[model samples]
Target: MTGGIQAQIERVRAELTSRPEGLQRHVGRVLTEALDLARAWDVDPDRVELATWGHDLFRAASPAELVTMARAAGVAVEAPDLAEPVLLHGPVAAAVLEARFAVSDDEVLAAVRDHTLGLSEMPMLAKVILLADKVEARKRQRAPVMKQIRRLARRDLDLALLCWADWKWVEERTHGWQSHAQHWHARAEWVRQHHGEVALPPRVPETADN
Candidate 1:
């Protein structure tokens, strides 16, 4: 952890102070999980801390607020993003972190950007933050299966991500909710890679925000 990164972490953490209490607590738990995973993965804890603090900067915003923020941050608002503005929170936060907060680390910004709906290929830091967010203490309590995912993450982050995506797929199907195209594409790639497939079957075009 360089002095600059530690400074960035504090700045991001300070920004998180004004968010809702529940969100702050959630971020706290995520920090705990992320730092542990960072150590296990031999990643820098300062970078993990910065991303964890910044990931949910806009989580508690209303849909209209999210959309407004997204536009202000220059985040593209796709159909899914307009329909579910919460999806833009990650991108919005990432943009703000760079433009406003001077967080210049590409991997750190990528971790914050992709934490909500993971990308097909992520830096190790992104993987740690994404898995940590999903398997935080409250989330594990809400979904018992998160315990298994959390355990798996310690050994295999990619496998844990695939399992979490599978669970998310089932969840959306059960609830009659639409799967975001970006995540669906990412999940498809993970499935293909996991099975060592060279090509994927034809599917709906990825045309929405994650």
Candidate 2:
């Protein structure tokens, strides 16, 4: 890592350590996962490291706070997002990182913005951070399917992404949570274009323990 990126990581770690344990653990896990995948994926380790550290900076903020931050950042807020403000954390965190920490790289900021709810044509670094966030060691403990995704990521990033999206879709359907329709459509399209009818692994049983 560059000296500058190392400094940024330290700054983020110092700030996050003072937050609640859940937030601290989440950020730590994402950072570790991102760094590990960076080498395999041939991405900039520094950028991935920075994005992971900053991605969840405002994850614990209240809905009203998220709205205020998003508006201040000039990010477009939708009605659904206003109703469920947690979804806005990615953009809000991206804005906050740039404003507060002097992280000006567009790719890094975009990765942070798209980490939670992925974009249709996300950058490779963005995909790495997003997938790392899902299959991080801590998260895999609770969601056994994440282990499979982690293994798949080592071989084929695109297929791993499709599986992650599929797993998320099934999870939302089972729990009756609102899902991001466009994100799924994009993942499906990307898989079809790249993989050409390759079969995805069977879904892990929801009731199974890791």
Candidate 3:
């Protein structure tokens, strides 16, 4: 990491240290995942690390606080985003990082914005951060399907994203949450277009009786 990036990391670390212990542990896990994936994927470690640190900076904000922050940051507060501010935390976090720390790199800011709800054609750095955030070690209470996605992340990043999007779609449908349906659909479509089909391991073909 460059001196500049190291300085940013220190600043973020200090800020996180003041937060609740649970939040700090979550950020630590995300950072670890980001660094490991960055090295494996040949992405810019500095960018991924910085984005991970700031991705959840405002995750605990109340709905009212989310609206205020979005307005302050000039991010349009649509009806859906306002109604379900949990989905807006990513964008709100990005805005806060940019405004407070002068983070100007669009990619880093984009990663922070898109980490929770991925974009149609996400950058590789953003993909890394997104997957890292989902599969971080501290997140141990995931369902079986989520465990599979986390395992897939160790082998193929694209496949991991596809699995995650697929799982998220099922979750939304089960919970009747439509706020992020478009995002999940767009990400799934993008993965299909770019990486072709993805699936679970196929069963071995039965040998013909001899």
Candidate 1 is scored at a TM of 0.91
Q: Flag regions of model 2 displaced more than 4 Å.
A: 1-3, 195-210
> Mind giving the per-residue lDDT tens digits that candidate 2 earns over 40-74?
98999888888888888888989999999899899
lDDT string, candidate 3, 1-210, tens digits: 234777876777677777778887898888888888888889988888889888888887788888888998898788888678888889988888778877888899999998988887778889889988988775646665666776777688877887788787788789997836658676767676645543645547778962
CA lDDT, every model vs. true structure = 0.93, 0.84, 0.80
For model 1, the stretches where C-alpha displacement exceeds 4 angstroms are 1-3, 197-210
Give the C-alpha miss distance for residue 10 in model 1, angstroms.
Answer: 1.0
Question: Could you tell me the lDDT of residue 128 within candidate 2?
Answer: 92
Separate clash counts for every candidate: 0, 0, 0
Displacement of the residue 65 alpha carbon in candidate 1, Å: 1.1
TM per candidate comes to 0.91, 0.85, 0.85
10 residues in a row with least lDDT, candidate 1: 196-205
Pairs that collide, model 2: none
Which has the better TM-score: candidate 1, or candidate 3?
A: 1
